[model samples]
Target: MTGLLIGAIIISFSSVMVRLANVPPDVAGFYRLFVGGLGMGLFLWRMGKLKHFTLHIWAWALLSALFFVGDFFYWHRAIGLVGPGMATMLANFQVIVLAVVSVLILRERPTAAFMLAIPMALAGLYLMVGVSWADFTPDYRVGVVYGLLTALFYALYLLSLKFSLSKAGADPLAMACAVALLTGVLLGGLSLGQGESFAIPDVRSLLALATLALICHAVGWFLITRSVQMVRTSLVGLILLLQPTLSFVWDILFFDKPVNGLEIAGVILALVGIYLGSLKGKRGK
Candidate 1:
C-alpha cells in the first residue's frame, strides 16, 4: 500500500513533466514509450525473465499498443488545450467508460453504485465545462472532447491488456514491456509521418523526458503493478485517485491554473463518481 501510494504520487508528475518537456505531444509520448520500453526490456533480460513471447500474446500486445497510441494522441493534445489539471481529470473518466463497456459488451449487470455514478460524473463534467458551452473558447471545447476520447481509448487499452494477461503463461511485466515497445514503434513512425523532429531541444527537456520515462513510466508502474496485487480493489481505486487529485494540485501550484469554486466542486464530484464506478460490487446477492 505504501508502494502504491508512492507510485501514484510519482505518476502524478506525468503531466507536469510533459509540460516541462516543451515538445510535440507525439514526441513526448514516443520518448516515454521507447525509452521506457528499452529500460524495462533491459531489466527483464538481466533478470532472465525476458522469455519468448507466444503469438497470442504478441497479437494482444499489438492491439493494446494501438489503443494506447490513440490514448496518447488525444490526451497530449487535450493537455495542451486545457491545463494539465483539467485534462488529467477528464482522462480519469476511463472508470466510467469501463463500467459502461462492461454492461454493454460483457453482459454484466450494473451495480447500483455504477448506475448512480453515471449521472454524477456527467453532472460534474457539465459543471467543469460550464452550463453554457458557447461561453468557452473553441479550443477549450475541443480539448474537452479530446479528453473524453482519451478515456475511451485508455479503457480499450486496459481491456486489451486484461485479455493479454488472461492467456496461459502470460507474464504481466512481459506484456507491459511488449506493449510499450510496440507502442513506441508505432508512435515513432507516426511522428515521422507528421514531420515532427525527434530532437530534444535542451538539457531541461532531456531531463524531463528521461524522468518521465524512467521514473514515471518504469519505476512508478513497477511499484503500482507489484503493490496492487496486495491491495483490495476498492481501496486501490480510491488510492489511485491520488494521481489525478495531486495532478490537479500540481497544475495549480506549478502552472497557476485558475480554479473557481464550481470547478473545484466539479473535480470533487467527478472523482467521487469515478471511485464509485470502479467498484466491482458483490455477486450472487
Candidate 2:
C-alpha cells in the first residue's frame, strides 16, 4: 500500500514532466514508453528470468499497449484541456467503471462503500469542472468533448489492464516489461500517425524524461500491481485515489500553482470519494 502511495505521487508528477520536457506530445509519450520498456527489461534481467521470457506473452503485452496508447493520448490532451484537477478525477474514473464491470461481469458485488463513493466522486468532479463547463458555451465544446473522451478512454485502459493482468498470470515485473514493450510499439505507431519522426531527446530533457518513464510507468505500475495483490482491489483503488491529490500537490510544489479554497474542496471531495471507493463491504470483491 505504501508502495502504491509513492508510485501514485510519482505518477502524478507526469503532467509536469510532460510539460517541462517541452517536446511535441506524441513524441514525448512515445519516448516515455520506450524508456519505460527499457527500464522494465533491465529490471527483468536483474531478476534472472530474462532468458525465459519470450514472444508468447507479447500478445498480452500488445493488448495492454493498445489500451495504453488510447489512454496516453487522451490523458495528455486532457491535462491541457480540462485542467489537472478534473482531468485527474475523470481519468481516474476508470476505477468506478472497473468496479462496475467487476460486479456485473465478474460477479464482484458492489459494496455499500462503492455505492457511497459514486456520489462523492461525482460531486468532486462537479466541483472540479462544473463551473468551467459554463464558460465553454458553444465556443470551447470541442475541447470539452476531447476531455470527456480522454476520461472515457482512460477508464477503458484501466479496465483492460486489470482484467488482462489478472487473467494472464505473470510477476508484476514481467507484466511491466510486456506492457512497456507493447506501449513502445503502439506509441511509436501513434507518433508515425501524427507524422512524428523519432529522434534523440535533448540532454536535459532526456535525463528528466528517462527518470519519469522509469519511475511513473515502470515502478508505478509494478507497485500498483503489488499493492493490489496484497490488498483488496477496492482498497487498491482508494490508494490510487491519491493520484489526483498528488498531481495537485506536484503542481503546487514544482510549478507554484496556487490551490484556492474551491480547488482544495474539490480535492477533498475526490479524496473522500476515494476513501469510500476503497472501503470493503460485507460482500466485497
Candidate 3:
C-alpha cells in the first residue's frame, strides 16, 4: 500500500514534468525512457543480474514496448492539447477500455457493478473535458481523441506485459529495461525525423527530464512492479486511482488550473466509476 501510494504520487508528476520540459512530446518520451533504461541497466549490472533474455521473453517485451511507446506519444500530445490534468484523467480511461476489451477478447463477463460503473464513468468523462459541451473546440476534440488512443495503447501494453510476465516468466526489471530501451530507440528516431533536437534546452529542463527518468520511470515504476507482485491485481488497480486524483490536485496547486463545480463532481464521479469497475475482479476473487 505504501509503495503504491508513493509510486502513484511520484508518477503523478509525469505529465507536469513533460509539459515543463519544453520539448516536443516525442523528444520528452525518448529522453525519459532512454535515461530510465540506462539507470535500470546500471542497477542490474551492479547486482550481477544483467544478462541476455530468452528470445521468447524478448519478443513479448519488445511487442509491449511498442504499445508503451504509443501510449507515451499520444499522452504527450494530449497533454499539449487538453492540458495535463484532463489528459491524465482521459488517458487513465484505460481501465474502462481494458475492461471492455477483456470482455470481448478474454471472454470475461461484466459484473453488475461494472455495468453500473460504465455510464457514470462516461458521464464523468464528459464533464471532465469541460463544463459545457460547447467548450470542446475542434482542437480540444482532437486532444480527446488522442487521449482515447493513449488509453487504448496503454491497455495493450498492460495486456502484453501480463503475457510476458506470466507465460514467459520474464523478470520484471529485464522487461522494464527492454521496454524502455526499445521505446527510447524508437521514439528517438521519430523525434530526429521530425527535426526535434536531442540537446537539452537548459539546466532546469534537464533537471525536469532527469527527475522524470530516474524518479518516475525508474523508482516509481519499480515500486509499482514490486507491489503488484505482493498485492492483488484488483487492489493494485484500485490503488492506482491515486495517480489521476493526485494529478488533478497537482494541476490546481502547481499550475493554478481553474476548475468549476462540475469538474470537481466529475473527478469524484470518475473515482467512483473506477472503483466500481475495479470491484468486478475483486468480487470474482
Q: Could you say which candidate leads in lDDT?
A: 1
Question: Model 3 clash pairs?
Answer: none
lDDT of 3 by residue, 66-145 (tens): 88989999999998887788888888888887777766667777788778788888889878764565866888889988
By TM-score, is 2 or 3 better? 3
TM-score-better candidate, 1 vs 3: 1
User: Model 2, stretches more than 4 Å misplaced?
Assistant: 83-86, 136-147, 197-203, 232-235, 256-259, 278-285
lDDT (Cα, tens digit) per residue for candidate 2, span 1-285 = 788777777788777677666666677787788878787788678779686465656666667678778777776666665445445656666655655566676676777777877798778767766756676545335544555576667667666766666767656577667777777777778788888767646777876677668888777766765566777766676667678777777667776765567657866886787667656444344
lDDT of each: 0.88, 0.69, 0.83
**Most TM-score-accurate candidate:** 1
Whole-structure CA lDDT of model 3: 0.83
TM-score of each: 0.95, 0.84, 0.93
lDDT of 1: 0.88
Candidate 1 vs candidate 3: which has greater lDDT? Answer: 1
lDDT of 1 by residue, 187-229 (tens): 8898999999999999999999999999988888878877898
Decide which is better by TM-score, 1 or 2.
Answer: 1
- The parts of candidate 3 lying over 4 Å away from their true place are 280-285
- Each candidate: RMSD: 1.6, 3.0, 2.1
